[model samples]
Target: MKRTVLPFVLLLAAACGPRYGMRVPDKLVEKLPYESRIELLESENDLALAIDTVDEASNEVLRARDAIRRAKARESAAEEEENRAADTASREVAKLAIEEARARVTYLRAKQRLNVGLRDVEQLALRCAFARYELARLQSTRKAKVEGSEKLDVKKYEGQVSQCEAKVKEERAELAEDSAQEKTAREAWEVKKAALAKKTFDARASPYVENL
Candidate 1:
């Protein structure tokens, strides 16, 4: 009876050991699934870090482009300002040149008037000299006639004196007329010259007064 009972107990123990070994293999398979999930999560995190780095690089590039654009705008504005200044300076120079030309013209006109007046005075003086010479000749002949000069041709001398006196009177009237004309011309010239002088002075002083 003891030998038969020992054999039956050994068979039962063998059956229970097979069942427990099967459960251990199943648990190891479950742990493998969890390890695979953890690996997948790590890969996703690495992909996100790569994307973030790319975004940062793109932002830097955009910032550099904006800086370049701003610098170009500033340069263009400076160029425009310089151009405006140059245009203004050119206009000022043109105005000054025109003023100088006008001044020169006024001076020339004044000089011409003075020259005309001087010429007229000279002509009047010449005419007066001629008149005085003719009067002297007529007086000499009349005095000779009154002194009874017998050798001299009386009719011829008297006729010559009369002709000379007439010539003297005509020359005197012409001289008087010329003198009056000359006086008028001189007065007009003086007035014009004074005006011209004032214009020249003003033109020369304008730059100083304007502080140009």
Candidate 2:
């Protein structure tokens, strides 16, 4: 009985030991202003990264536009080829080629617009999140000052806090609207892709089907 009880106690101690060790430093850090500072820095870093990503997305939209132009040319050429084909099988093949090129153009155009909307949403989301961290840091610093000094005038911080709060609220609203716009854009792109995919598939399979 004694041996069993000792092992059980040791097992429980091992289970709790790591968590206790972790909590001590976490609690110590929570007492300092460094946590809020780190949060603000991270938010800034995220916003900067998001801006770079938006720029890349813009470049992709340009590339997609170029591809779309090439695809349209291919589609027009396929139409002319279909007109010149002398036999039924040859015409069917050219028709399928036209459908494929048309599909590519449709996909590229929708994707270009979707990328633009997504980047706008992403930038707005990061801006909204950064504003929250900024407000948190401002409030934390104001609290620290009030706690550390007996003569600190609380009214001095109110104006700055109010402005930060207003900024956060405004960005939050804009983020919501931007997210909705992105969702609508994505849905529209999906609809276009689905319709084009069905059309292209039917064109490819038409030669294999027998008349009823």
Best by lDDT: 2
Model 2 per-residue lDDT at 77: 85
Q: In model 2, which runs have C-alpha deviations exceeding 4 angstroms?
A: 1-39, 143-212
CA lDDT for candidate 2: 0.52
For candidate 1, what is the TM-score? 0.25
User: Tens digit of lDDT per residue, candidate 2, span 20-107?
Assistant: 1111112322554665556546644554564566568778768777877887887888799889999886687677667666656666
lDDT of each: 0.39, 0.52
Estimate candidate 1's alpha-carbon lDDT, on a 0 to 1 scale.
Answer: 0.39
State TM-scores per candidate.
0.25, 0.47
Off by over 4 Å in 1: 1-151, 202-212
Candidate 1 total steric clashes: 0
Q: lDDT, candidate 2, residue 25?
A: 19
Q: Tens digit of lDDT per residue, candidate 1, span 87-197?
A: 675444434333433333343344334444434433333233322322333334334343332334445434443554465465555555445654565455445334433
